[model samples]
Target: MTVEVVIFVLMGLTALGGAITVVMARNPVYSGLGLLGTMLSLAVIYVSQLAHFVAAIQVIVYAGAVMTLFLFVIMMIGVDVAEDTAENLPRQRLVVGVLAAAVVGFAVYLGVSQGFDWVPAASGEPVAEATNGTVQAIGERLFSTWVLAFEATALLLTVAAAGAIALAYFRRRRAVRE
Candidate 1:
């Protein structure tokens, strides 16, 4: 097998293992750590595909900034507390297990039957220049074409921060009252 294939397989396994850990972990902090692993592995995969700009953004924005926010939220909400294992919905665990197994089986079958055949973009072409993962191209499109969507995401994040603060304040007030 080629080095690229080996690296791809390793990264894919790391990503999948991290996802499973995130789902199965009882500790919120561990789950966040697993998510960070998954994001970092994905960033590596992006880099392997020659998407340097995207890889940088993935590491900086998702793995660094987003994971920091997630970890902060988990710690703020008391990471020492264990999650309750009470099953609110009957047969939920069984159903979910079956579904998860089926999905895994399908993925395995696809991988074994049809191996990945990635097509690299033609370099030095006009289309490639426009679509290549470059900082200048991304900035141009983000600022000109997707500016509204970008602003909307910022507004959404602000609202979410305000809500978290409000919730924390109310909980603190109730605790003091009690």
Candidate 2:
């Protein structure tokens, strides 16, 4: 009926398609692309909700940087679809999928039953005159209380990057030797 409703519907479709693509696609790179599409749609949803800062961060961090990392890993690993058929279609995978589905369904039910009572944009009264999003508050908190955790995340990212490079290098070396 309304633009918001339409956007929400589109977002839902985007999420559904992305999830299906992730599970069904033979190519890891295509799966990553699907995830990127979902992330971009989620960013649009955040923007529609007036969460500009979160939308920007979602685009930059998830769609841009993290997707790049994912694509890099996928490319480096280079799993062959033909070789992965029977090995990947295990009972454990089915069980995990069922469990994940149950969890998501329960969460959705709980949210729909309880969360819709609350008014939109009325959750928390604005505390400050500043309309700036969570960035400033987050920066202040990080510098004061969460500096260690923030630095830890950076360190983790550095380690991951180094590991990726090492894996790629080793793969190339093995190829040359073979």
Candidate 3:
């Protein structure tokens, strides 16, 4: 088999194993680690497919930030807590099942009506300049073509962080005063 095919198969299996571990792990930390493994494997697969930008984002965002958050929360909450098996809400499982079924049914209906064409295929026309998805090329494109959108996203993230900090500060102050 080709190297690409071998990489695809190995990463695919790693992702599957990580998903199984996430589901089957009894410890929250183990589950978080499993999710990290899955994210990293998916990133490798993206890189193998020549989706360098996507792979970078997958590793930077999901594997780095999100997984760090998951593990932090898991650590802060303590892992040895007793499980609460009591059903506080009546028929919560049934409600969830009904909602899941409805979502699936709606998806099936949409697929049937739209002929499963959610995203239209790309055009056959060859581009004047094809990018190899290198970091330099991506950076040039981002700064030259998508600078406004990039700055806007940065601004949005900053505002969101400030808002979260403000809310947490106020809540903590109130708790201290109480």
Candidate 4:
């Protein structure tokens, strides 16, 4: 088999394993680590595709910054690591699992039927220069072409943070009163 094919297979396995671990892991920390593995594998895939800027950004932004943040949050929250004490494993899980399977099936069907090709252009055309595809290009596009969407995302994050803080504060206050 070609080296490219081998690399693709390896990355695919890494991604699949990470995805499974993310779902099956009892500890939130392990799940985060699994996601980090997935990100790193994906970055390697991007590098193989000659998307050097994207690959670097993937490693730096996702595997480095985002995963670090996720680990910190998981550490701060301190989830119980025991798998045995997991409650309500049936009805809700079944529903979610069914939905996820349906989505995956539909996606696979669409992919097979459409036969989409995303091969980069091979002609030695001078592509417009881009700064390393860091979070900066993403931010620029978001602020320019998708300003409203960017604002909405920021607003959503703000609301979520506030809500979490409020919930924790209220819970603590109630515990103290009791």
* Candidate that scores best on lDDT: 3
Over 4 Å off, model 3 = 85-132
For candidate 3, report its TM-score: 0.70
Q: Once superposed on the true structure, which residue ranges of model 2 sit more than 4 Å away at CA? A: 79-82, 87-90, 108-115, 118-178
Worst 10 residues of 1 by lDDT: 117-126
In terms of TM-score, how similar is model 1 to the real structure? Answer: 0.64
Candidate 3 per-residue lDDT, tens place, 1-178, comes to: 8788899999999999999999889888899989999999999988875678889999999999999999899999999987686999999989999999999999999988998676766466636454567566889988999999988999899999999998889989999999
- At residue 140, give the lDDT of candidate 2: 77
Cα shift from native, residue 165, model 1 (Å): 12
lDDT of 2 by residue, 76-169 (tens): 8875635435665569878988999999999899889988665555545545544345566556777899889988999999999999998889
Better of 3 and 4 by lDDT: 3
List TM-score per model, in order: 0.64, 0.61, 0.70, 0.59
Runs off by more than 4 Å, candidate 1:
105-131, 136-178
Residue 152 in candidate 2, Cα distance off native in Å? 12
Across 8-122, the per-residue lDDT of candidate 1 in tens digits comes to: 9999999999999999998988899999899999988887766778989999999999999999999899977776878889999899999999999998888777664344544
Q: 69-90 in candidate 4: lDDT tens per residue?
A: 9999888877874446556566
Cα error, candidate 2, residue 153 (Å): 10
lDDT values, one for every candidate: 0.86, 0.83, 0.88, 0.83
TM-score of 4: 0.59
Query: Clashes in model 4: which pairs?
Result: none
Worst 10-residue lDDT window, candidate 3: 122-131
Judged by TM-score, which candidate is best? 3
